[model samples]
Target: MARGRSLSGPLFLLLGLAAGITVGRRWLDVVEVRGGSMAPFLLPGDRLLVEAHSYESRRPRPGELVLAADPRTPGRELIKRVASIDDAASAAELRGDAPDSSTDSREFGAIPLSAIRWRAVFRYWPPQRAGLLGPGH
Candidate 1:
């Protein structure tokens, strides 16, 4: 009985840790910025913490940063700000801070809402620019 009790604590801890990791991976993702599209705001190499289930309950709103599948390139993802939402079309227009460097809705037209799965909620890398991503940041 004593030996069983001692093992139970560590076993439970390990199980909990495993469960946490699984849940985290399912709902969260780390994205590394690659271009100057969002420059002056989000620079290259900036790592962002994106929430996969962010749009599960509600449609994305304007001004929010999001990660979406690139329409031009299959299997590729792009991070940009929501420029506008078209409820009638069930699509959203995305734009980067630096228009000159971005290939966004302006080039591809509005993207279907279903294509957008992740919302960029925070910046976690580089230490100095880490914080919640939103207006006035």
Candidate 2:
């Protein structure tokens, strides 16, 4: 009844998987924590699953962890909390959880909306603390 495998079924499945992965990449980003700015909650070397689509889908709010482009450095990324917001400009005043050790809004000023790239939604590393990331501890 069968001398060889049917490739049509397997080919379609592979194609479907590829398409899904491509589309999924657009909504999520994998980032690694590089500093102690977001300490206690997110330490250096911790990996984050960022929700890129959230910034595109909704307005960012206070106390939320957001991935943004460093104002002083081109192409570098920073993760900080929204301590305050400027509704008039639709921008945010970002700060680190450990303010004393952070170079944030106080150093470079509020981050423009365009500089924001994604919202930190989950921590997928260090099995002990793998789950959804809320506003605070």
Candidate 3:
């Protein structure tokens, strides 16, 4: 009876950990800002917690920060803000906080909404600047 109880505890812990990882992968992701495109609001090296499920239920709104697949580079992603959304067309125009430094909608044109995979919800790294990110930030 003692041996069985000990094994059960570890087994349950392992199962719980596996479940957490699966759920995390499906709904949550962390992305690190890589360039000055989103400067002032999100600088390079800022780590953001992004959620994928939100967009599944509702369309993205203007001014929201999002992680999208770079149209110019396959397999690469870029972080930008939603400048406008066209529900009828299923596309969104994205832009950088610093327009002069960003290669966004201006260069590649509005991207398909399907290309946008995650919405940034919080800045968790660079402790001093960490906080919940919103449309205004």
Candidate 4:
């Protein structure tokens, strides 16, 4: 008869490494919905897995929702729809041609691409709701 042995040192180390990688990828690498800035699409507490990429590489589309750092609150993240990019829509807003209740650089100022963390593709959580997020214009 043989007695069960405790976890070996090497096994414990590997387990720890795996856990760390998973946590790092989930928490540090992904973005979580924290406010109603993206309401009707994403709600607070919703989790999104952000892929590692350069924000500058991808041009902001008209209806894509993005995760950007809040200029008013440092270290805080915000999710908002990309009303427009390249200052075209902004210029239009200046001319009073945009939406009446628009949420864009006009209110928060133009944020750099580096501040963006990810482009939300879908919402997954709360069990009742989960699906691809369509363009919101």
Q: Write down the TM-score for model 2.
A: 0.81
lDDT of 4 by residue, 8-123 (tens): 54345345435644866642244566645455556678865444343546555667667777678788766667655655423111111133533556776776655655666544
RMSD of each: 9.2, 9.7, 9.4, 11.6
lDDT of 3 at 53: 84
Candidate 4 lDDT for residue 43:
69
- Per-residue error for 89 in candidate 3, Å, reads 1.0
Q: Supply the global lDDT for candidate 2.
A: 0.78
Model 3 TM-score, all chains together: 0.82
Q: How do the residues 1-137 of candidate 2 rate in per-residue lDDT, one tens digit apiece?
A: 11134655434534543564477877666678998977877899887777777777777889889988998999888899999889899889999999889999999999888778689876657646655678755
Regions of model 3 farther than 4 Å from truth: 1-22
Which of the two candidates, 1 or 4, achieves a greater lDDT against the reference?
Answer: 1
Report, for every candidate in turn, its global Cα lDDT versus the true structure: 0.80, 0.78, 0.82, 0.54
**Predicted structure 1, TM vs. truth:** 0.81
Clashing pairs in 1: none
Candidate 1 local lDDT, 1-137, one digit each (tens): 11225556445634543564478877776779999999888989998767777689999999999888898899998888999999999999999999998999999999999988888876657767655677434
Q: Per the 3 Å backbone cut-off, how many clashing residue pairs does candidate 3 have?
A: 0
Best by lDDT: 3
* Residue 66, candidate 2: C-alpha displacement in angstroms: 0.5
Quick one: ranking by TM-score, best first?
Answer: 3, 1, 2, 4
TM-score, one value per model: 0.81, 0.81, 0.82, 0.59
lDDT tens per residue, model 3, 11-46: 563454356547877787667889898889899999
